[model samples]
Target: MSMEHHPHDVFFRSFFSHPDTMQALLQLLRYKQMVWQKDDGPLTPILPILFYHGPDGRISERFSQLFHPETPEHLRPQQVEFQAILYNLSSVHKDRLTAEKNLEFQAALLSLKYARDNMDLMIDELYRLARTGGTVFLSSKRFALVKLYLLHASSLTYDEIEQKIHTRITDPVIREDIMPSTAQMLKQEGRQEGRQEGRLETVHETVVRMLAEDIALDVIARVTGMTIEQIEAIRQQNDQTDQNQS
Candidate 1:
């Protein structure tokens, strides 16, 4: 599948979709544009931040570094000069992420850093967060997003994931809220194993669930083993169903 359709791409894009993640860039451009258009007030300075979480380290921080290396030093001063605050999750220590006071932010960074290669560590941090952060962590929307990320990003089976969640979170209500039903898991496994036929309805339901979660079409296609065309059709049908019911 294309990188654009990849599960990790979807997961990260969804995880970072919150405004706070891109607030700096938004504010910077908005204020700068306002200052230019209105010419009534000084431009508010804003820091630019780039959050990166790839297997390799970031190559450069300064915008000017992207220029040709042979560019003369004398002319360098004319080039745009600015450094973004880089939060390279790959380089950040797990301890530092765990130390983050904001439980939601900590979970996001940890998931980004370790979800692929370090599932054990990721689960451990999540367990820790759930245990320590208590009702607040369990109730937040981030918890659901994190759970969804793990479902797609990790190689662990659905039962294994549920077991881990069960082991970590002792509250029955929270566990019930977090875990998918056995029927759902079986349907997911059958879909993954390419069992169609009578399962079309099941598959459509799964697609609808993922779509409701704001998962990308390509990502849903990958997960459900459906074509983008099919998923789009289901989405349209779903929209019509909602419209007619309303």
Candidate 2:
């Protein structure tokens, strides 16, 4: 696909992109909490717990496409096709077993209510995921994203949640691999000097160069919120750079 119309070009196009979907994700997270509370607040290892929420294909496809892009060019489109299944799996209880059967739903509204009803199981599940090694934290999105937020967002020891789910991230490589803005650019933002127009132009060029080398889009997206189209536009802006490099 051309960069101009690359199918999964937008970040907000993410399955968890919508506010309602985000809320549903949060609700599902509650299951992890309830699981712990029932134990009177201490978590111990149990089963190789696997938390699967919504099964929407769009999300699953995005996760596949965005995560394992080098699989094969022709098969890349398959990633986009499963987005709905991803969302469906990431939210609501379907085939998966939860402590409360009554909290099951076929749609988002019902799922939210169901989750609220069974919040205790969700908490226990979270605590279980945090304390175990083989625990599978498979959501349409990264388990760490929510887990980290919960650490400070709640009074509960979210760190225990990290431990059980095996989410104690030691990704020093992530910090190193990501590009840093220039000293001057960093200084302005730090000092409340605000954005300077020229800085944006320079940053754009830097991001474009990074993208052409087939850098992971997740990394690129973190560095620049520019749509994939915008990043590709940088490639077009500097044809000489494109021709001269990867």
Q: Count the clashes in each prediction.
A: 0, 53
Tens digits of per-residue lDDT, candidate 1, 1-246, equal: 001222221111221222233332332333234334533454334344556654573345565666688999899888765555666677878788888889987887787677667776777777678778877886776565556556666677767777777776666765675565433555553545658688777677777876665454544665667897887688668766865786
Instruction: Report how far off residue 139 is in candidate 1 (Å).
Output: 2.1
lDDT of 2 by residue, 1-246 (tens): 012222322111112222223332332233324334445434632211122332233322222434454677787665422232232334544335344332211122222222323334444454433334222432212342232222222333433433422332334332221112112333332222465666676567546554443333333444455675666566456654544674
Q: Candidate 1, which ten residues in sequence have the lowest lDDT sum?
A: 1-10
Top candidate when judged by lDDT against the true structure: 1
lDDT of each: 0.60, 0.35
TM-score per model over all chains: 0.52, 0.24
For residue 36, give model 1's deviation from the true position in Å.
6.6
Q: Considering every candidate listed, which one attains the maximal TM-score? A: 1
